[model samples]
Target chain A: MKAFDYARATDLSDAIGASGCLIAGGTNLLDLMKLEVETPSALVDITRIGLNEIVPEGDGLRIGALVTNAACAADPAVRRGWPLLSRAILAGASPQLRNKATTAGNLCQRTRCSYFMDNRSACNKRQPGSGCAAIGGINRNHAILGTSDACIATYPGDMAVALAALGAQVEIEGPGGTRHIPVADFHRLPGEDPSRDNVLEVGEVITAVLLPAPVEARQIYRKVRDRASYAFALVSVAAVLRMQDGAIAQAKLAFGGVAHKPWIDPRVDSLLVGETPSKALFDKAADLLLEGAEGQGGNDFKIPLARRTLAAVLAEATAE
Target chain B: MAQSPAARIAVNGVTYEFDGDVRRSLLDFLRRDLGLTGTKKGCDHGQCGACTVMVNGRRINSCLSLAVMHDGDEVTTIEGLGAADNLSALQKAFVSHDGFQCGYCTPGQICSAAAMMEEIREGWPSFASEDVAGRVHLDDEEIRERMSGNLCRCGAYANILTAIKEVMESGAKP
Candidate 1:
């Protein structure tokens, strides 16, 4: 941790126009700073700006970006309406970290790739154009889908996967004005420019995450990790299904730890919409979801692991 | 934003004013500046709960937060839990149950356990809770899931579980 100036934001404008990285929970950012992976000249503390509200907005819930993961998970509305989101948040971090980690910070969390975190390694995500060490080094936990030759870092978040499955929208405020970005498009695939994780411009602050009306369906979030707790996901699944007359009426599937973004493909749901909920149908849907997934040598197992995890989630969700 | 002046913080019941680097973590501040080395630094990251402490009635990893971020906030570390001659009930329980072998991660484990019990009393739901809306029953599985952050290298999990069970059964308030 290097010497840096710190300023506590008093209002939205103070946080919006800050010249350095915004600090809410300071869980991930501070760790990166300690590793010298993230060296911000200034730290703008936004925890006191009063963005921790979780209120009803229009037909759904609008979660303030500064809401701590613990509070968001324990909110009655979230627990009843969006159990998948709550479960996902709890599954991601331990109780202590969840108390300090914020919703915006979780969504903005960097990759957990060992190469990217280690400054000694040549990681394009850490230093643009340097080189991608994960492409040739130990990449058992790297991304398998939506990866490019430049980088293969995986997005390490559980809440974001559920958010992407629920069709959540992110609210951002910048120098220009406020705007809304769908959660699916918020993160970008690893392309030539793997340095940029999301589409946020300079001096842009995420205000709130808008979750659409809760669907009347069975929701489940299953995360498989190396250990029972406090470890990043190997491959997680968030499945929501609406069953009618022993048939799948609607479905939504999102995967984590397999891609640069929350891998959500509507094609699988479309294929299962009018079909009977069975192991055969789920296997077919899983196969369709992993159609073009290419894997590094060490991470080749993730393709089949993700497919089986998706199938299990679908089975549990559509179970009577 | 130039270098700010010395920040003031309240740990336990004492107020301390120190001129330290803003980038220094709360764990470093307590250990280096205040000489409160009871709180260990196992990983220096949020992954390990060796730096756990109570801030505004909630438990958080001090290593995950900068020292200046806690200015004017009420903090309670392991040193604040009890005096050497007068150990807290939870501490006494840990000793009786032999909850630790190396004792390196004891302070944080106790502090986290104290706060975790309060969270359960307030109807906070955990990922493994059977009934989200029902009372949080104190069981081995629940305690293990809640205390998963605090890793004991000596592997004293069975005794740690016994200590927490004693405290919970005694109906002690944090």
Candidate 2:
């Protein structure tokens, strides 16, 4: 790791205005630094900035940026109101990692693309203008939905997928002022500039995540991976469903490990509404969600795997 | 050249203040500076839990944390758990169960299990839990899922599981 200046910011303004990379639960950033993948001249510790609470806001909840994943998942309000969020977090990294990884840190974590982590391989996400090695190389874990000519790395996270399905908003504080960005629009696709992951601007810091009022729907988060635990999702599905008169009243779906961001499409929800839950209906919804999903050689299986996983989650969610 | 930062941390009930490089990990500081060799480093990355330690009562990967970030924090390492002459209940179970062969990941496994039992007592749910909001039941599946962070290359997982279950069944505090 490179030598750097470290400062602990005592206030939000001090943290946002500091000219350095923000550090909270240095689980991801420090690992990248050890590999020299992310060499920052300075690190501003934001753990003490007093954004570590999970409080009730109106009918919804506002989760502080510094709340660790384990704490967030174990909170009584979160478990009772947003059970899927808790389940998604628990489905992610092991107990030790979830204890240290924070809410803002999880959203800002980098992709697990081997080529991107390895400095020797050509990766546009790590270094702009460099060719993408995963496009032709071993892409078994690469994305199939949000692929670009520049990159095909998947956004490896589970909590964000649940947030996207729940229509959560990200609160940002910067020099300009505070602004709220919908979770769906927070992450950007790997287009021309794959180096940038989210819509966070320079000197801007994520303050908290604003979850809307809890909905009267059954929520489920199912992940499929090579291992039973301590592994990233090969393809995961987050589903929120409401039934009325033996028919679907509302449906929201978000997919992970299949795109550059949490993949969500309103058309699939529209198709499921007013219809009874059935494999045929879910297959059609899967068709709409997987539209134009072209996979690289090694990851072609994800296309069908995502379809089956989505179907299974929807079926389990609607089961009597 | 710029001067290193000064940080004060309490480890094993003893407070130490020093000036160190900002880039040095807490794991490195413990092993190299404090000479706490009980906490071993398996894979410098967070993927391997051989460097696990408790910070402020929560277990975390010491290798992924900077020592400077731990200012004013209380850390409990393997040495803090118990000495060789007076081994902790969890440590004694490991010895009787033959939970390890190489013993490289023992400290991390013990620290993690110690904190994990606390999590279970607090009704924290795991992936294996059928009900997220309900009381936690420490089944074999739950133990394996919770301890997945620590990797034992000796394939002593069966013994480790037995040791942890024994402690839990004995109603002894780890």
Which candidate ranks first by lDDT, i.e. highest? 2
Candidate 2, residues A1-320: lDDT per residue as tens digits? Answer: 88888887878887876788888998999999999999999888888788899999999999999999999999999999899899999999989999999999999999999999999999999999989999889999989997899999999999999999988999999999999999989999999999999999998999999988989899999999999998999999999899899899989999999999999999998999999988898899889889889989999999999999999998987887
Which candidate leads in DockQ?
Answer: 1
Task: Give the CA lDDT, 0 to 100, for residue B86 in model 1.
Answer: 85
Say what the RMSD of model 1 is: 1.4
lDDT tens digits by residue: candidate 1, A1-320: 77678887778898887887899898899889989999998888877789899999987999999999999988889888888888888887899999999989999999999999999999998999899999879999999899999999999999999999888999999999999999888998989988889998988999999999999988889999899878899899998889999999989888999999898888888999989977888889988898999989999999989988988888788888
DockQ of each: 0.63, 0.60
Model 1, stretches more than 4 Å misplaced?
B1-6, B131-135
TM-score of chain A in every predicted structure: 0.98, 0.99
lDDT of each: 0.89, 0.92
lDDT of 2 by residue, B16-71 (tens): 98578888899999999999999989889998899999998899999999998888
Q: Could you tell me every candidate's TM-score relative to the true structure?
A: 0.98, 0.98
